[model samples]
Target: MIRVNHRSGGVLVLAVTETRLTAAVAPQFKQLVLDQIEAGNTRLVLDLSEVGFIDSTGLGAMVGILKRVGSRGDVAVCGLQPAAAQMFRLTRMDKVFRIYDDADAAVGALEQS
Candidate 1:
């Protein structure tokens, strides 16, 4: 299951709770995130602390979300568990998205960028 917790303060934080972010579920999650981004939201922080794994589809979903926000906005990820964090590193996505230890750090990174 995937759960996105939305927060304010010029930053929209999405907390994902799922064993895997694979093709089976990435699309739905992508749409949900897209909806949030389109709703006048600019800064975003995706918290993957509870997500145990992420497949290529999940990576693609994140890339799509980043594109949706574009350079006009910023999107960072936080709290990625070890497994998911490894995948990001393997795919070089860790370099793509600004990653931090927690939501506050991500928000700070984005604000500073």
Candidate 2:
């Protein structure tokens, strides 16, 4: 099961599970993010520490979420497991998103930036 945790640092941390985020769950994920944004909480940090894997749909969903947050707000990622991290690197999304070692570090950096 996939679970999303809205953290106190004002980051909507989506701690995914179940190995992969496919089309079946991408829309729901996107909607959750949109709901957060509409609630005036725009800063987001996807905590992929628990996600062992992610497919193209998952990556696309993340990109879509980032776009929704826009340049006006901060959207970051951190604590990616090895398999997921490899996928991010392979896709070169590592350059697209601000990835950190941990959630606290990401939140702090976002606050400063």
Best by TM-score: 1
Per-model lDDT: 0.84, 0.79
> Which residue pairs show collisions in model 1?
none
What is the TM-score of each predicted model, taking all chains together?
0.89, 0.85
Expressed as tens digits, the lDDT of each residue in 1-113 for candidate 1 is 44655554677788776778889989988888888888877788988887888988898999999988998688999998888889888989889989999988887777676
Candidate 1, position 99, lDDT: 91
Model 1, C-alpha of 70: deviation from truth (Å): 0.9
Which 10-residue window in model 1 sums to the lowest lDDT? 1-10
Which candidate has the top score in lDDT? 1
List, residue by residue over 1-113, the lDDT tens digit for candidate 2: 44666666566666565566677777887787778788887887777776777889989989988888887688889888888889889999999999999878887887776
Off by over 4 Å in 2: 1-9
